[model samples]
Target chain A: MWDYTDKVKELYTNPKNVGKIDDADVVAEVGSIVCGDALKLYLKIDDNDIITDAKFETFGCGSAIASSSALTEMIVGKNVKEVEKITNQDIVKYLGGLPEEKMHCSVMGHEALEKALKQLKGEKVEDHVDEEGEIICHCFGVTDDLIRRVIRENNLKTVEDITNYTKAGGACGSCIPKLEDILEEEAAKPASDKKKEETKKPLTNIRRMQLVEETITNVIRPILQEDRGDIELVDIDGKNVYVALRGSCSNCMVSNVTLKNLVEAKLREYVENDIVVHEIK
Target chain B: MERVVYLDNNATTMVAPEVVDAMLPYLSGKYGNPSSIHSFGGDVGADIAQAREKIARFVGADHDYEIVITGSGTESDNLAILGSIAYYKDKRHIITSRVEHPAVISLCKKLERDGYRITYVPVDAKGNLDLAYLKESVDDDTAIVSIMYANNETGVIFPVEEIGEFLKEKGIPFHVDAVQAAGKIPIDVNKINCRLLTISGHKFHAPKGIGALYVRRGTRLRPVLYGGHQEKGRRPGTENVAGIIGMAKAAELAMEHLANIDEMKRLRDKLEEGLLSAFKNASLNGDKEKRVPNTSNIGFEFIEGEAILLYLDAKGIAASSGSACSSGSLEPSHVLRAMGVPFTSAHGSIRFSLSRYTTEEEIDYTLKTMPEIVNRLLTISPYWDNEKQEGKPINL
Candidate 1:
């Protein structure tokens, strides 16, 4: 049912370098049978740091095997350093394309090659270690570092993108909130740095007013609109800005929490950190 | 050219030539509204009556009126479960096996969300329903108990007769989803004593849009749909005349070939035995002797099933898998997982289902092509190293 490319189908049927090199320079395996896909790569790297031969044994679906096969073909006769540059996207490109859900197969191939190079360097490599962060998704054993790296490397925009690339939050989905936190953090990385620069300057009274109005229109009002509520900037007096909650927010039980946590937080972040808000009842 | 061996009949069947022949006149020349007062409509109504008679006889129901033609097996299931719950407003509980088809399970889930208590009777590793749990779960508030006659994935027939007998003593309504069992095996309302049973036309040799629900006489059911007096106001709409005729024809043919079920069994056994023997790490997933004659679910260790299925597909052999990739999820088949099939093998499980039209040659082709495919995948599988490792049990 996966719309695998003709090249993927061809490579899966008659995968090249399927057997293992018994006396190889380095052997690296990634994934597990429990996770539904695993791959063991046997590499024969020569003295010049060039991969003389590469073979793989993969336990997974057709796309996984095809991705492994493509990885082997792409790495053979190439420098070990250059092989490190070949990302999962490169393997996907070699196979023409894989279904969005099966992109993790190509990621597995890229990971095996990375592990093989690390093993060839005589480093003590442990299987399944993220090398960047702790495990976040227990079902798939996807670490926070892996999720973050994929989000940054692939310019991932949604939780589904992370699942497609790294298989986080694709099972059980209990870690979905954690993945969302990571995505938000990664997405705000550039903006946060820019915010620090903008925060250092002294706030002109007019600039403070415009910034407060912009934050309300662009951020605070939209959040309140989700609950069928609205807010109006009644008046602004220096650090104290007076506002009135309208619609559903007028008599809401948690309107105070919304004002402090949502409204004041936006004002502190966008305007001066000392800005105070007053509700005009 | 490839041989094109179709072993996915459990998913859907090829429309038989005879069934098409029987339905052709209704599609064109005999296109009369069965509800009309004209003679043209009267003749069509008479044909529907005859079809109903044959279908009633096929399922061993007492009267033709017991068979209510619906759009699909899911509709019949909805009609039975929702209708029973609606009829018994004071009762707010339902009991169903964990492995019932999504039609029953999902509807139960919706009912649960609607403030109804649902007791999902678990099954053992062999896919047998926990009857003691079912008995314990039933209370005064139990509205109905819906269990499938045969599992669609594994084809493991449940002890519906025993369940029926138990529920009969308790005076609780029982519904049986017989979609997979209708044409493959014999079904008798008298033997099972079920209050309602569902059948899909396409599961046999009929077209896809027709199904039947057998409601035992005196079992009051609120109509799920309302329009006209079609299907005696049970399913109200214009009747799918040709589909109903085709289903009746399929039922007639099914009755005629009831004795030939052994032939299908023989082919299935041959394929199962050959594949299980060909691969040292392979094993059967469901109850070997208690399954339907047409189905064989096998688990091949180490390798994933979608890979094997794709390899088999390339060889012109069609099979299905319980693997996560095949199912469009990261979790493998829930049925297999519920059976406690380890993740290692559950991801590698494949199902081959046969039909009455299967040939021994097709079986031979599958037997010949399967080993090479498994062997090829095994060579690439890191776990396949001439030794068996008891796979770790997965929580999914």
Candidate 2:
């Protein structure tokens, strides 16, 4: 579960403006059911273009709901121009903090507020549209050139890593093939001597298995045996491993904890840090 | 250390103490390959036979020889579906419902790629399968009709026995993935007339990485994995002796405690009633009358399921969302989508699956804490704001 701040929880439980204002000067609806979150905002404006009253309805998770709720509370007494200037960062700050993944929830609220202001002024919301002739992955709005740049800079090993860096294919997932094409295109390019300075060392499966077995027998098993437990290496797949518990350790209640902390930690320290150890039954 | 309340038994269960005791010897001093010709091996084989008998008795199968142990419930599912398709290569059609676990769904996708035809039957708003569609989908070319006995997400019980009986008359093989329902509900493979059934050890109080499939004596299947001549070569690999022992012991315990299932059903209903009465716009997902004894899916309007889950977690209560697996990913649950649950309520659906371990105090605490959280999230929802606007026409 994501850790929610007190402020986020408070706003979630007792959201400031939660009803529709009749005869509002501005209204905005953003997101769709497919996106798994939607926000609708209503604004009551005074003669001076001040947002006298603001209310919101959101269909989303706690962060989305709380962020929308908080957004309404922040903008009700502010002028329309000021509301337009509210950023996602500001909304997140107002809620004390939001998990990084949920940052999009705040961005959605900010976008809805801006769209509503545009609707009030009889103007179009034109921020997301691009006129640069630079093709963005239409599915997720990640530019083709940006994907190339990320691949070139990060020296990324897989398409999934590129997703983490650029948020490409993170939404809609239709951009995955295009992203893969870019990765293959980059891999085909010639590399300078300096860029390929280090020689790749491929460890044999037998050697890898030996190292895992030794680590468990020499390090992990002894430590666990102190608690009347022991671990045996079961299977090794690259850096990932499967270990079986023996003796008293096999049926210990805290076996998962031991596997995660002791066995996995020791193997990662001695070998690669990306090892995922599963406890064998 | 702080006390942790484990209400997430539906996800997986803690092994029972007696089951653990039964498994201890195999993991330590009694360790011996069941296939070895030595005296130790004979002893191990005898224990495996005992476990097979216990599991067979638990599910009310006619013979202990019908059980074929495998790696996990997923492996059991794979073996049943894939193995059956392999045996009857002439019959290419497979029928199943939309709310199956990924184990079944992903395997079906793989089979589809391998040129097998698959028809996914739909479900009602309450997550109940359409039996008429199931009957319609099956024909002479249909090799197997695979459906879950009970849904893992909504806990809605499917009419497996009726479907099994229907297909038996037509001479088509019926396979039921009874992983979630095996221990919770009484299952008689002979009565259901199902040629194949799948069960996972971890769903009950058995350890993970061990499960069994009940293949009716005459059913033909090809081995998916090959090495040793274990499980009568139906599932050829070294046996998971300790896990099988634990599973048998767990099944025995489940059978012993079967009479008290009503107590769990009462607790689950009480939890559902409290949540529905306390929270506005709250309703249960799936048919209330046709669900498992210890599961309830409830939707709290205008609140995201993740937030509710986080709140419940913070309060030391463990529950899950129908959308939890797909929470980070934007896909609203396929189960909810298939059931035609409205998107608004589907996103807010929380699954509170109870176990025999769930207590009255825990239910009371959950009921008390839930309404406040729902009201809090709803207040800020833009959907709520939009509903209000729709209620009263706004004049510019």
Candidate 3:
């Protein structure tokens, strides 16, 4: 129905690694019985912190199942630190792309990866958060912080978009009114923030370009530097900011998405929403 | 695996050679407007008359003029219900089943927005219609009672003849969407005693874009389309001459092969029996005995259906899934959901429909290949705990 890419169809029909790892060092499961799709991830990490193997068990639609399988394939031989950088869009990119409604399936893959890493790091996982300021979407295990952040980052305007992205109100829909309130609050946020950023903008073109370079240095450089990758600001033409992806980042499968979503998104949040980032080969 | 085992016949059937032979003349040398004054065009009109007569005979309509040709099964359904409502002015209520095809169901929804009250009768767990509820829901204001003769998903045949008689007694018009039932089983419109009945050519063996609606003689109805007088001022448009000719040939073939349909039933039963016995936690959907001859809707627990369908597709075993993942909308089939099937099972239902072209060898291939795919998906499924799994899920 989604017009699934050949890769998604292939992996779903013949998944690479399935079932649980008997001696899996880090096991993390996300998604609840209330939610339609559920996924459990198992990671076998070696002494040097490289993931020796990974496997997954999923109960969901074609995209959910395929995303889980792709996630398993993605992190199998990578370091735990590098695995932590795997985003929802990375899984989506690995499978060509999922339908917008099925984007939550890719989000599940990202969360499963995070939960497993938290386990490996001896960090506490929220098994059941009944405390106040926690568990806003009880139908799903969606925390208030996650919902607020997704709302802010994606500039999500409605409860339906939130559901499509994070699967917050996709279940019983009891939390829909609550989600609407949160959405209202989040919607009012970026306008004031944008106004504040606009007030601080330099009038001169040279100063504006300098500010763009400084924003890239302060915000996007550190992220790419971690992956033995870096970015250099090439030029700024009006709203378009051109940058060359240096090192392993250029060869990375999902670097284009990272450039648009991660780099450009951060630039827009920090600088201006009108900024359109382009990779200089 | 190189060979295909097509089992999605309720979706569409392969055109017969004879039907194609009849259509070739209309497509090439005999292209003439039936309404033209030319003798060549008049001969085409004569051919259409003969074709109409054959289709009328096939459906047991009393008069050939009662058969009005339309663009498709969907158009025929739209034309019948909409036409009946147009002619019957002041009536504002409609009744249909929960599992009617989207052609009818969506139209009813649109009508509801324009101040029409529509009652959707539910079905039992086995996909059997609730006749008592249907009879009780009918009223003097009811415009038309549009119901499907057989379900496209589960192949459950409704009691159209009984319902038709009951509606006739109430002096209310009835429209039957027999697109799925027409060729697979007998359709006697006179015996049905309905105001209208619709059947598509492609469902039997003709090419797509051709269908006929049976308007009982003197059952006043309006046309959805407006143009030249092709179907006796009922469906006014230049005729799809080639398609109508093919449908006539196909109808003749369908009548000839009507008894041989039991062969499809035997293959379907073998396929259903083999799968049900071979796999644990596998079961059937709809009424086991009341279904059309060549359909088997099977539900396998713990795995989603689109994955299964894709796996089967990769293996060249054509089938259809009722899961939300298979549909454009992210909701499980309305038919399965209306039947009160559990979320676990409903999300995993697959419809394997056969035709006269099906073979035991194809069934054997399907029976052999399906369990392997099911077993693989089940192992990958989180709900299907291997530890709880018994000796072997698949008998083979």
lDDT of 2: 0.78
* The best candidate in terms of TM-score: 3
Using lDDT as the measure, which candidate wins?
Answer: 1
- lDDT for B81 in candidate 3 is 90
Q: What is the TM-score of each candidate against the true structure?
A: 0.84, 0.72, 0.86
Give candidate 2 misplaced runs (Cα > 4 Å).
A1-29, A32-34, A40-58, A65-103, A116-281, B324-326, B385-396
Model 3 misplaced stretches (Cα beyond 4 Å): A32-36, A45-50, A77-81, A117-185, A202-271, A275-281, B388-396
Tens-digit lDDT track of model 2 for B1-396: 455566677789888889999999999998998888998988999999999999999888999999999888899999999899889989999998899999999999888999889999999989999999999988889999899999998899999989988999999989999998977889899888899999999889898889999999989888898777788889887888999899999999998887899998988999899988876678788998998898898876555687678667667877888662225665568898888876567778888877777788888888888876776566545545434422122211
For residues B266-372, write the lDDT of model 1, one tens digit per residue.
Answer: 99999999988877779899899888999999998888999989988888989899998888889888889889998878999999999998999999989888878
Model 1's TM-score against the true structure:
0.84
RMSD per candidate (Å) reads 10.6, 12.4, 5.1
- lDDT tens digits by residue: candidate 3, B1-396: 377788999989999989999899899999988888998999999999999999999999989999999989899899999999998889999999999999999999999999999999999999999999999999989999999999999999999989999999999999999999978999898788898999999999999999999999989798888887778889997999999999999999999999898898999999999999998868899999999998899988777888788888888988998876676444578899899887677778899999988998999999999989898878887777688783223111
Candidate 1 on A180-271: residue-level lDDT in tens? 99999997886756667576877889999999999999989998898689999999999999999999788764456457657887897778
Q: List the candidate 1 regions with Cα displacement exceeding 4 Å.
A: A122-124, A193-281, B386-396
lDDT of 3 by residue, A131-234 (tens): 12578777566888778866664556678878888877765678899899998887677686677767774446676687788888887898878767899888
- Candidate 1 vs candidate 2: the TM-score winner is 1
**lDDT (Cα, 0-100) at B239 in candidate 1:** 89
Provide backbone clash counts, one per model: 0, 15, 0
Order the candidates by lDDT, highest first. Answer: 1, 3, 2
Residue B214: error of model 1 in Å? 1.2
